[model samples]
Target: MAPLSWYIALSASLFVIGLYGVLSRRNVLIVLMCLELMLSAVNINLVAFSFFLSHLGGQIFAIFVITVTAAEVAVALAIVIAYVRHKGSLKIDEISIMNG
Candidate 1:
């Protein structure tokens, strides 16, 4: 079995990569994908801790996170579709739907 520290290190690395993507990317779809990567890292941590502690709470919370992430993706994709239909672009810097 892999050590808990290894899992933690892996999770941290994935989270940093995701964070970098979220901060440096201009495309909305890429940003959303990075957000999902970050959430997956969190889930990894949750499951790792749950295994080490012999409890189900962390796993349950991870499930809730997955559920929320799914819903978020659905809603965000819907918004992106609408924005593309209206403005014809997915670049974050080009979005100005609220401008008066």
Candidate 2:
């Protein structure tokens, strides 16, 4: 059986990678994917802690996170589609019309 610390380390690494992707990527779709990756990392940590501590709270929170993530993805994708329709591109740097 793997230790709790190992799970935590893995989660942390995933979070860092997601952060890097968000910061370094230029495509809006890629950035959204990174955001999902970050959310999954959080879910991993929640499940790992729930397993280690034998508590239901972490699992419950993870479920809530999943619900929120779904809502966020729905709203975000709608916005992305709107932006693409208006701008004809998915690159973040190219869509600078709102920078006033």
lDDT tens string, model 1, 20-91?
A: 999999999999999999999999999999999999999999999999999999999999999999889999
Write down the TM-score of every candidate: 0.95, 0.95
- In model 1, pairs of residues that clash are none
Instruction: State in Å the error of residue 24, model 2.
Output: 0.6
Model 1 misplaced stretches (Cα beyond 4 Å): none
What is every candidate's alpha-carbon RMSD to the true fold?
A: 1.1, 0.9
- For each of the candidates, give the backbone clash count: 0, 0
Off by over 4 Å in 2: none
List per-prediction Cα lDDT, in the order shown: 0.97, 0.94
